[model samples]
Target chain A: MLLSHPTIGRLVLSAAVTCGLAVPSYAEDILIGVATAQTGGLAPYDQPSLAGFRMAIDELNAKGGLGGKYTAKLAIKDTRTDTAATITAVQELVDAGASIILTPCDADATIAAGQITVAKRIPTLTFCGTAPVLATAVGDNLFGTYPGDNLQATVIADHAYAKGFRKAYLLVSPDSSYTAQLPEYFAEVFKKKGGTILGTGSFTMGQPDFSAIVTAIKALPEQPDLIMTAAYEPDFPAFIQQLRAAGVTTTVYGADAIGTGTVQGLGKLVDGTVYSAAGYPTPGGALEAFNKRFETTTGHAAESAYEANGYEIGLILDAAVKAAGSTDPVKLRDAIAGLDKLPIVTGTITYAGTNGMPVRAVSLIEYKDGKPVFIATQTPAAADVPAPAH
Target chain B: MLLQQVINAISLGGIYALLALGLAIVFSITGLINFAHGELMTLSGYALLAALMMGMPLLPAAVTAVAAGALAAVAMERVAFRPMRGASVTSLLLTSFAVSNLLKVVFQNAISARGKPIAMPDWMAGVVPIGSFTIGVGPLMSIAVSALALLGLELFLRRTVMGAAMRAAAQDFNTLRLVGISANRVIAVAFLLSGVLAGIASLLWIAQRASVDPMMGFVPVLKAFIATVIGGLGSLSGAVAGGMLLGVMEVALQALLPPSLAPYRDALVLSGIIVVLLVRPNGLIPAVDTARS
Candidate 1:
């Protein structure tokens, strides 16, 4: 009786056909290469990006494959999160006939991959590479899904000026290339806004003790209203906890690194700190729909800027493929460069030039009771900050 | 500022002291650096994490961790170290390195697969305010536990007859064998004591960070090596003194240097060690008998 029902019969016939023919008929299988550090120091960033990328791929396939003909097949190679591994992974992906390649997380690995892709004339995208030098060196073949680190510094400085924090203590890690540049950027912005640098302190990476820095900060004659640190995840939590333990409860602010799991792990100790991030938590329109779909597919929260950037990178790549009408490397690159204003999960992204930085918006977030609450979205003013002379 | 720096130095020193003491005991008896010693500490930390996850209370979890460390050491001696006991020093050293690498890989995979920071209980969080400065309970507990462990170790090495046998074996295992003492027993006791010290160190290290990762042992072990070398290589008292001295020097350097020079702190400390070694090649406190030749 159930089999005889019209609706049930139609469903059975559709399932049989899909199983027998629909999946087997491959008009064209477009292979996209992903080289990421799935198992090393960069695993935290890479693993989540992998999840996001898969979610995007699944959604794209469900919506009738890219270019209205080919279904995307993501071939992933683990870079082991090392520079040497990243190079090898990229080579492997290229060997596997990947037309478009997604590179690893950090600047060094991403840059290395970018060089290879550029030499090979393949289109490459990075989800979280923010090294300023990379953006300047790489040409049109390379694109970043996230805003540059300069935007993060500008946003923080603007937010701090708005909050009446005119006096700031800058703490940076001299050993880190990333951290070293942050204070310089902040100093340029804060000084321009008429904020005084009260004092400066430094800590070494991998040094667990922060008491000395905390003691020095406490010893300042007039306490600064804000403490701005440019530190990585492992060091950030220790620095904040020790700063609080030393009875220095000054409002803390930092660059995009503050928006990582390391800060989240600090729990209540991270309360009352604010930072500038490249992406917003609650995206609108298509992004909102994508986020919901991403969460359902990934079975984890897509809350981080890195995850959003990864998802957006997938969407952009899909769009470029569709626009190019072919998987040809040069055509895809040209199509991507020609996009005037592509709305992504983060915000509107416009590629100014092949060598120029992409125009992207930044968001300011404040940590209230250990959660990064949305504050305001603002496009940072063009940085008037001069780069340090060689 | 002086008092705070001194307190910071002592607390930092306590961690080093525990690490060095654990290494010292094993080296004194086995004549091996036991490169795997740091990994033992890491293994104990992970064991404690596992125990905590299994709903054991803090104190019981700590005890289990210590037991696990001791058992792991015993197993290492039986399987790896014991086979190459009388071989060239190079063979034993290579075996230790191999053991360390194997453990590191296993722990790294285990931690990564879990993909979360090892959780600590709620009671261990926050600071206990005292006067103008607030001290973290973890650091305070580290100092206290290290002191107690050191005291207990001193008592065990001096008071018990088994302790006398251990000392004799360290001095001359062959002579101890002639005196009808089992060298195996002495070696086992040394491993057990080292495990206990490593377990205690793991607790303090975890308390300070409130998380455990496989790479956690790398720095601690390096510090321990430095402490042992700065302390007379074979002297237990030297280990303790050297650990305290290193901790104080590190804090002092941090306080004195400007922020820009902070990254060079390690280089500066190593330079100081070289100067000390140049002045006293046998270390700050040379081993009493070994210094003669």
Candidate 2:
């Protein structure tokens, strides 16, 4: 009404234009709530993904924030790898006015955190909730950026079957949902392919000795052609050492959990062991370039492909935010769902119609000379991929 | 095959015995369980890695690792445990527990929660074969080192003046004090001996794990603590016997249990121990009590 005055309106319009041109700062800020396992058992897995987020956020800011109008700030809270603590952390983040929440990598903790966020209608993204059941369990508010475990299982199963290996002995660790559900998925796919499971072995996480299991495997009348597992870290290395030292030369296969730099530490002990990977650090490629950038920024070579998995999350989210043109959780969730063939550090990811799980290629990598060697990137046919276990 | 399994059991049991004996030494002298004994082992493993990284030769690195444990134990006693001298058994146990968790947190936050790979010697991972039977070198070294450490402890306790003072203190601290032996010195020496034993046990553990993490000491310490309880607390000989028996039980279960029962092997081993404890409450080789008068 005041601007309707002929002289005053012309003067006010000129002043508004002048002020708008005077500052290059953002018009809005987006607070990203990060609840992750920063200091406990899951830290090794979560920290790398956090590093990728940091790198991606830095790049995003460098490019004029979000579409030259908004800047993102991470409000991080440590979950400490406890489910109850995770619940509290997510609530605290939401209460502090976060528009989006990032959860810990493991499914149990992610679900614990997501329940609160989903109730608040906030968008939640898991660092690496590979379990397919997470999509249904947590509803549409949650998104898992990491490749689903079922996809990796199918790829590994198909590859093993192609090698004329019909018999498999599975070593299962009931420690985490990732470790527990992955072997079951493999068995599901492998059995469907007409292969027989020789036997199964179980262990709690971080079992200091695998000699007992090794001995039992040795006593089996017919040795398995290949052994499959999703065990990680110190446990996996210990198992491999004892298994090989006992003269069990069967080929070993694994899920994405085994595709970390930790196996490189085993040197020749892990040679010929093939595992499904979320991404590979290809030479002179985009992933390698990002790795170099990560090294320059953090002063350490990227520890694992998890770093790449995390980088992909950032790129995908940034694209989602741009496509949405707003930071509202609903709009952002919708935008995320509409993403298609988006290139990230790892590879192209498609979330459209994937039901919170991204459809992406799974890399198969082998250890040679104590280093990861990329074999092939596999994308199982939609018909071949087993449905997510309810 | 049976012989090969027996060898495996002995080496695995040897580690338990070595660690249990370390705990026994501290408990005998100070009446404290030294729950941090496991942390001492963890410190030694990290020290060994750090030394090797610094271009030290294998022998010197190992010596440094052992020495690191001794120094940490002595310092821990002087700085943390000494101020509470004559405190109740429960109080000292809690203090040690606090100390153990504190060190593990430091290892988790200040260092890393993830496991760091320990570059092992080739011979440690290698296996020796004899007439269609193959045995791992790690087990053999564990057995040999454990035997040497035990024999050395025996000679020290029976032969040296300081060792005699320690033994006397174990029997009766007041009588040793009446004869002019300083309680602090004797307790410090006991800690030193225990730390050295823990250091050796760390090597055996690292050989099997091939990696070091903040929680690396958890299982070993838990097993050794169980062995101590089964062997009769504060009795060195009992601790060794209990550890050996526990190892043998574990091997037997592993060899006998069906594949379906493999995961329950540890559970069965524990149940068998419970039965043994029921039969012999004071452990297999209970310590003798000396006459006060």
Candidate 3:
């Protein structure tokens, strides 16, 4: 009855205009703002996800756009992994009639860019950030589109327990929150699964020499069943090399931090190493097909599971857009929060009743003959998952 | 346990000493710290990787790395620094910083931000038994190769006419020119020798990490600079001693510090250096009065 009144309907359109909501039209452009790092230390992590995100966008365009009507256009801005630059890029995107926003794969940069989108009341989410704090850091509008570090650590611990690895030693790199906190959560989850932490050894990331840490681990009264460290690139190579040189060949476990092509040339040195990832290709599953499309589109193989995460971002946007029946940021944000068991290329993800981080299955992967071989995808039991670190 | 940690200290120190000696050689002759010295190492690393890709054997690839470093240094001196031959110290230092950044950006754009994985020699990845003690073969090679490089540089500096010319230039460049020794040759030889040392350091660095990136030389060079200062700037032998001391102090703290305080190891080493400087302002082995005045 209210919509039947022409004057009242005109007032509603004015109100929407005043609130900075773009009126959705059947053939109008739906701006998906992408403010991510294209170059810098974060580039290695951000680029592959960007490639997958582009693939998803291309697939949507082929299907006559989102919800088979409005054309989705990606308005990309490179943040260059700088905080001030991230803020500026986010502001520029919001001013350019953006409907939804994507942040970088890092927590600091995500929070930096998300702060502006939050202030603007736009729905924004990190494409591949694993930090749990992002869910609560940048107001209620920002959401996490990646698996949390706590969840990954729990999956690792649960899998390690299944492999009969009971005694663990944590290699903590206090230099990064990702490196530092993942091991703590792994310790908690491992303890819950009837494991004892033999000891904790510390090292700074990018430390060229890991001999001191290796010596400390070798000196442990009991050799750990597993050594868990979230250290990546340059650091992981040196650590694995030194650990081998010390003749202490305890199984090493890690998270997605080392999931890049870092282990490709490592050959037998890292053959048995295990780590958790957001997704991995099953023999004939959706992820395999998605990866094939990614290679054909990007002219290179998907670098990491982050590519899978990126594609899921598109599925989420589509689901939210369809549910909300409009591109308004406020409406889209509520629609996304209400998504339930939405199936993706990786696995089913549910955001309903969550603070914003999704509940998704994690893939346990291992390197065999210098190639990543998927082992299993499992969602750790709620009791085994550790509480998110502050 | 102590012996193993000691071996670790020596190996790590060898790299610092090698780099510090290289930095000292350039500074002693040119009166410029040459921050781009780090880029020399990175250049050598990429050259080594390229050589490996060309199907060269490991031995020849190593030679290529060393040669590439030397040639790059010579070219760098000819192109960038030669123009400002008599510039003030600040001007030369700033130029070197700019060159360093320029090279890093080029590497990032032309190559990649990710590290290129390098599969090292089997011996480097294995352990060697010294009687009842086992040590990494890579670390052992670092110590031996660096010692050999240091000895060769010392012999070259002491026994050759070019070496005396370099030392004379360090003491006072104008005086050397007054004596009719060519200043350009002395400076050129200084950069050449510095590059050779950097090549050796780069090999050791890559052996440890098994990968190379655009800015891989940054931290090693930073540590080497500190060692040069601690050893007294412009003193080659002092730089070596300072590097070994810094390496030893680092290992000691890493071994002794509690887990909660381990992150402070770098801060502690720096503070200790300050104390050493406070006690003896000229460094452990200060250079002979760099200026006759």
Candidate 4:
């Protein structure tokens, strides 16, 4: 009786065909390579993205992949978050005969892999590489699925300025390129907007002690309206907790790295802090279906905004492949670069007329009583974004 | 403002002292700068996380975590360090480094390379105000715990026979071995004491940081090494003094340095330390070749 049902029978037939038990006479298989940091400091960023990537691919394959002609098969290699290892992973994926490659989230780690994909002329998309250099310096073949970090900085600066925060104190983390660049971008926008930077401090990553920084804040001659920090996890929560505990309740503004499990772990201490990130999921927005599938696949709901960005890679690639009408590397690369206003899971993504920075809206999420609530979505104005020297 | 900054310095310094003392204890007895000691702190953090996840109360979880550190140190000494007895300092240092990396890798693969969040107790999150200044419960706890631990360690070293044997071993290892004292017991006891210090340090650190990661131990261990060098290697009192000095100097530099020069604070502080070491090569309190009183 179950097999007799029309929908169930079609599903069974699709499953059998997908498993290759029932051979299709004219079916084609396309191999996509994924070179990512499956295990390393970058793993946290890439893991969720990998999940999203798989979910998108699964959905496509289920509905008959690529005009019902090409079924995508993945060749995955772990980068281990090391440059040498990343190159090796990319080489392995390329050798596996993949037409396209997906790189890791961290820009520095993604560069070497990106170079390989560029040399091979494969269309390489990064799930969350925020550095603007990925667009300008890496290569033309390398495209980023996430918004550039400069856009995030502009959005935060504009948000703070709009909220009447005239004086700002900044904190810099000198561990990674992303953290180091955040303050520079923020200071640039804030200064340009007639806001005064009251003071600045710095800390090395993994240095748990923030008391010195706290003491410095308390000793400031004049209190700033907002405290801006560009710090990553483990250190991010520690900094926020110590600042609040020391009774310096100035509104804290930070980069996308602020929306992490570590910040959530701070309970009520993280309240009132604001940050900008890539994607914001609504109750019935584009992400609802993917989020539900992601929950079933990962057994947990998506935490980071990059999940949507990760899911976008598949949609972007599908669109590119369709536009190219061929799986040839050069043609696909050109097609992806020429993508204009193509709707993806996050929003409409277009590589046309812009540097590798994808024109997308960033969610300004603010913490209220220890939970992040969607405040507003703002698109970074092109005039507001400063071009990177590189 | 001055009063609050001073409190901040002392609280921060106390933590450094606890870490430095652990390094000092093992160094004085065995002359082995145990780089793996930081992994013991990491282990303690994991233990605390595990206990909390199991729904244990804060005090009990903290105790369990500290005990885990102590046990891990003893186990490490018994398994790894004991085999390399009478080895060159270079070999021992290499072995310690190996142990540190090995532990880090294991933790990374087993748990996560990313940090795991550990919730703080509400009591530890409170801020107490006195006059014009306010102190966080986390910092207050760190200061109180370090002081009590140091006092306890001092009493134990001064009052116990085992402690006396450790001091004698530090002064002259061969002489202590020849004088009918079991060198093995003395070394093992030194490691046990070191583990206890690291365990206590982990509790206060986790309370403040509120998260755990495999790499968490690396920076603190570096600070401990720096503090030990500055305090006078092998001198317990010197170690404590050095830790407090480093903590205070760091805070003071951050507070006083102008905004433009602020980012150079660490560089300036290290330069200052280098100048001091140039003057006092043996450190601020050079270790005297004598047993503890």
Chain A only: TM-score per candidate: 0.85, 0.90, 0.89, 0.89
Residues B206-277, candidate 4: write the lDDT tens digits: 777878888778878988999988988988898998899888888888777776676687888898889879
Error of 1 at B207 (Å): 3.0
In model 1, which regions exceed 4 Å deviation? A1-33, A58-75, A91-101, A114-118, A137-141, A283-292, A301-303, A324-337, A354-357, A383-390, B46-109, B113-139, B175-185, B286-293
lDDT of 4 by residue, A1-390 (tens): 345474465466435433434222232767787778877677778878887888788778887775355777665666777889778777766765678888888777777787787776888888788887786777788887787778889999999999999999988866666887877788899999999998788886776778878878877899999988878777787887788777777888888877777676666877778988876777787766667778987688887777777888888888888888777778888888899999987678889877666888888988887788888888977899877645
Off by over 4 Å in 3: A1-27, A30-33, A61-80, A84-88, A91-98, A325-327, B289-293
Per-residue lDDT over A6-43 for candidate 3, one digit per residue giving the tens place of the 0 to 100 score? 44654664355345555443445688878888766667
lDDT of candidate 2 over B160-238, digit per residue (tens): 9998898888888899999999999999998999899989999888877777777677777788888987888788898
- The local lDDT score (0 to 100) that residue A253 gets in candidate 4 is 86
Query: How high a TM-score does candidate 4 get?
Result: 0.87
Error of 4 at A260 (Å): 1.8
Model 1 lDDT at residue B32: 78
Q: Of the candidates shown, which would achieve the greatest DockQ relative to the real structure?
A: 3
Q: Assess candidate 2 and give its lDDT.
A: 0.81
Best by TM-score: 3
DockQ scores of the candidates: 0.27, 0.37, 0.52, 0.44
Worst 10 residues of 3 chain A by lDDT: A17-26
Taking the tens digit of each residue's C-alpha lDDT, what string does model 1 give over A120-178? 67888776766556545666687766666666677788888988889999888776446
